[model samples]
Target: MVIQHGGRPEELRAAREECAEELGGEPTAPLADDAELSKFYDLQVEAYECLVANGYSPAPPSTREAFVASYYAGESWFAHQPAVPEGAPIPDTVCPQPMLADIEW
Candidate 1:
């Protein structure tokens, strides 16, 4: 869960706690850079593909927001075990707020 700066810290913390309860684990702190973020997306995509290959036919929502909503509802690919483990520790060198121009995409 990438928490953008829309809410107060306490609100964000509460939301994170609620999400952890729903998802069955706490989310890692936001990824430090586009590289890490890309890696995260890649891992998720890989997991989704693996689940599909294994006959887990998750119906991903058409829109990103819908996907996220489904995820929070425990009705998305996130509900299944991934082929790879989630939440490997990120190094400190990756900045929390990386400049978009510096990222390779």
Candidate 2:
């Protein structure tokens, strides 16, 4: 599943567990040990650094409860939004190669 936005660890872990339950299996171990998983993990670290460099996450941390509440509330709000009309424009960012390359993997 695509995690389109960011939130606290507790919420993220809970959602992953729920997804695993729906899939009829246990939540898989994180790729800390697997070679391919490690690559992506390193990439995420690089991505986060890039975000910080680009002024995306210099904000102070919120409490866990507040963070989870915000995620749930945001999801609820989005669910009630009207669908986009055809031909609407979308914006995206390319991952910063310099950030990824600077990371020690």
Candidate 3:
């Protein structure tokens, strides 16, 4: 049960609240890029390959039941690679503090 509405932060928040009222639970953000947020460009190669394999066509509109059937029917699909590039080292993503302990200036 995924809601695919597109909107701004305030609008999205409002929509989430409305949804929570009807659904009765905390809303979950789809954190798809948690594993390889830094290596997005590198992963695009594998996705391109998969897209080219399945008749090189875009996905068709369908219901949840139809979508599941289409998915398992060996239709065209995309997938990203697991590993990051060797030369492009992973970044240090720590949040910076407002004031430094030892200021020279």
Q: What is the C-alpha RMSD of each candidate to the true structure, in Å?
A: 14.8, 14.9, 19.3
Compared with the true structure, the alpha-carbon lDDT of candidate 1 equals 0.46
Scored by CA lDDT, what does every candidate get?
Answer: 0.46, 0.42, 0.38
Clashes of 3: 0
Give me the candidate number with maximum TM-score: 1
Q: How accurate is candidate 3 locally (lDDT)?
A: 0.38
Candidate 2 regions exceeding 4 Å error are 1-33, 58-105
lDDT of 3 at 7: 68
Query: By summed lDDT, which 10 consecutive residues of candidate 3 come out lowest?
Result: 94-103
lDDT of 1 by residue, 1-105 (tens): 554646889888877887788789854665344444344344455545555665554333234444444543555343143334563332223212123234444
lDDT-wise, the better of 1 and 2 is 1
The order of the candidates by TM-score, greatest first, is: 1, 2, 3
Report the Cα lDDT for candidate 2.
Answer: 0.42
Alpha carbon deviation, residue 94, candidate 1 (Å): 31
Residue pairs in clash, model 1: none
Residue-wise lDDT of candidate 3 within 7-90, one digit each (tens)?
Answer: 688878878887888789685665323223223322333333454453333232233333334443544122321133232322
The number of clashing residue pairs in model 2 is: 0
Please provide TM-scores, in order, for all candidate models, with all chains considered together: 0.30, 0.28, 0.23
